[model samples]
Target: MEFDYIIIGAGSAGCVLANRLSADPHISVCLLEAGPEDTSPLIHTPVGVAAILPTRHVNWAFNTTEQRGLNNKLGYQPRGKTLGGSSSINGMIYIRGHRTDYDDWKALGNTEWGYEEVLPYFRKSESYYGGTNQYHGTEGELFVSRLQLHGVTKDFIEAGISAGHSHNADFNGEEQEGVGAYDVTIHKGKRWSTASAFLKPIREQRSNLKVITGALAERIILDGKKAVGVSIRQKGKSRQLKARKEVLLSAGAFGSPHLLMLSGIGPAEELAPQGIAVLHELPGVGQHLQDHPDVVISYRSPDTSLLGVSVSGSAKIGATLWQYLRHKTGSYASNCAEGGAFLKTDPNLDRPDIQLHSVIALLDDHNRKLHWGHGFSCHICVLRPKSVGSVGLTSSDPAVAPKIDPNLLGQEEDLQTLLKGYRMALEIIKQAPMAKYQLQDIYSADALTDEQLSEVIRARADSIYHPVGTCKMGRDENAVVDSHLKVHGIDNLRVVDASVMPTLVGGNTNAGTIMIAERAAEWIMQDQATA
Candidate 1:
């Protein structure tokens, strides 16, 4: 079968691409997703994200090799496998990151990628609950909103107000350096995933857009040096599908680079040693890997925390039923990461370098216990990590996981920034308003000194769930893609996902990734018209 465009992953980026590209009615687009449908009840029920994290059903729970810097500890990395990808299973925090983050891309020679240029595309895809603005779009497909109803969140907001930092009305508003309960990708208390907000709504009308789930793309079928199509395996059978115009790779940070290398488009030195034929000899296919690693600062709460309510025996179960019956609201509908802030780690830095996520529950080792009590934890993450890593092919086998080494905390600056963030978090907890909540420091009471805290930070740092830049786009020779997202060494082949980020954004990658795809779709369509 042949398609005008074949998008490899039906994730956040691919969903937007499918919609925008198929809108022509003349063009036929086929979107393939390796995971099953986004039908998990846990996915839609915002708070269910915590429950879905450890499961293999919707998440690809990949772990990294031991980091030599972090006392040889392996880090747990989770990628969404469902239709909407990570947007469907993530914490649902809607953050676009710093404006300068995009401007930095322009400085790197990507002219069309400045913050002001991409802001419209960001607004174009967002259906903001708040009215449209110069920075926010109101009539777009992706849903964004403030919490409709939440109890613990209200308390946390008050605590922030008492903590001395500015209480921001909107994190996506005029200013970003304040504490506030975050806006989320939810509609009427249910998680509005990319599949729900974009793809599902227009599925039936778009007969030209065909979506295939449970189909894993093995590699791009190259005709000489060009990506002509993809070879996919599904139900124990292999099928060949051709792309007439382009084979767009939206397979994300992990899948996209692997497909490129499998199709013979990576570093020759690396592929040759793995018994894989190198087609393009491009050395930068998966060279720049980045992610935000965070450490949890937890305390024992003197009051009833959401964790206690959700985990208590019959009373907890009864309260959930009661809340659900009354207003379709309860702990079941919150996306866990209710409170967040983008702040500067130090005055000397150019932009806000830290992000904090306040959750009303006890999260010990990724929430891996049935134990429940009144507890609170704030996740402190360095927004701009100095350390860089890479993603490489383990073998020619499609089933093998790609080797991911984020090389976290590789630089002295990264450690110092994160250490400063940790200090600021403690300061917030000690403030008048938060102090009234009777938050007792529990994680490291034994390590009270600054030097001891540094040890604690290094020992327990984990990902805040933003991973990007494996196949970076720029004007440099080592760049894998051009400014327009087209592969550097191939024609009619582009990577339109988080993998192409030149640098990790100062906040969540979901919003930035979706905007990239929205812009990429326009670029592809406009190029088609000109051609």
Candidate 2:
């Protein structure tokens, strides 16, 4: 098969790419996804994310190298494999990150990425609930809604406010410092994933676009230095497809850089050792990995405020499910980690260095372990860790997952910041709104000394599932892509995803990923027009 544009990975950014590129009407586009079609009912409901995310079918379910910081435990790294990518199975927080996150990119010589310049793309991709304004868009493809806060979720916000944290109604608005309900990529009680927001409406109408699911992209088919197409395998059959113009990779952070390495476009030193022939030697293909390092303070709530396996809590679950079915209302509509805060650990800091997620359950070990009864947990992650991580080949085979080492707390300061964040969270929960909900502190609060907290931080610090920077975009020698997102030394090729973020955003990365795709699509069209 042949097309004007071939997008590998029909994920968060890929879905947006498919929509915008095919809108020209004359150009043809092919979007390939590794997972099966997102037809599962679990992909629609907001609560269904909890059911689908832990599974391997709809998720990549990658695990990092045993972290020295986390008592040598492998961290859970779940990347969405289906049409909407991670956006399909994520917490669906619609945070664009702090304005300074983009400015930091510009500070690194990515001049086109300042907050003011990229704000338009963010607005262009969103159909915000409050309608069009300076920071949000009403006539856009993606739907962004403020989740209807449940009792405990609201209380979490109130508790943060009582703890002297500012009450921010809109995190995406004038300022990002505060506690409030998160705006999620959900609408009308359904999970409005990127595929739902961008692809669903145009799939039938766009005759020039083709979407192929269960198609695993193995490598880029390059002619000398130019990416000509993609080599894919589906149904035990390998097929080669041509790209008339561009072979855009929207394959998330790990997939994009891994593909480049597989295509013989990475550092020859790493490629030769992996038994893969080197076609192009780019030292920075799979370097500079970064992700949020988080630790959870799990507490048992005596009241039935948090979800758990208590007699009353279990009964409420049935009633909530029934309510969800009848009117799409109730606690079932929550993203689980309903609302939280973003605050700076130091007063002199220009922006927040730590973020909190007040989950209405005991979110221990990324929900890998189930505890006894009703409880609420506060998750605090160092927003900007000095620790650096990396992604590399575990095997030459595409079927094998990449080696992810998010070196969480590899730096001592990262641990110090998280400890500070944990203390702040405890302060909030100890206050009025949340104090009433607590029966007793799950871990004896008074018994938790600084040493005990340090032990816990090392034992529990894991990712919040926001891994980025494997294929970094910048003007440096180690950069994989340029400011325009074009692969540094390759033609007809570009990576449009979170991989391009030179640094991790100050908050959830889904919204930033969408903004990146929005800009990429527009740049692609602009370049095409000039051509």
Report, for every candidate in turn, its global Cα lDDT versus the true structure.
Answer: 0.84, 0.88
Query: Which residue pairs clash in candidate 1?
Result: none
Per residue, candidate 1 scores C-alpha lDDT tens digits across 397-432 of: 787888888888878788888888888777776665
Predicted model with the maximum TM-score:
2
Residue 266 in candidate 2, Cα distance off native in Å: 0.6
lDDT of 2 by residue, 173-237 (tens): 99999999888888888889999999989999999999999999899999998999999999988
Candidate 2: minimum summed lDDT over ten consecutive residues — where?
438-447
- In angstroms, how far off is 272's CA in candidate 1? 1.4
Q: Name the lDDT value of residue 377 in candidate 2.
A: 82
Residue 13 error, candidate 2, Å: 0.5
Q: Report lDDT (Cα) of residue 68, candidate 1.
A: 62
Model 2 residue 324 lDDT score: 94
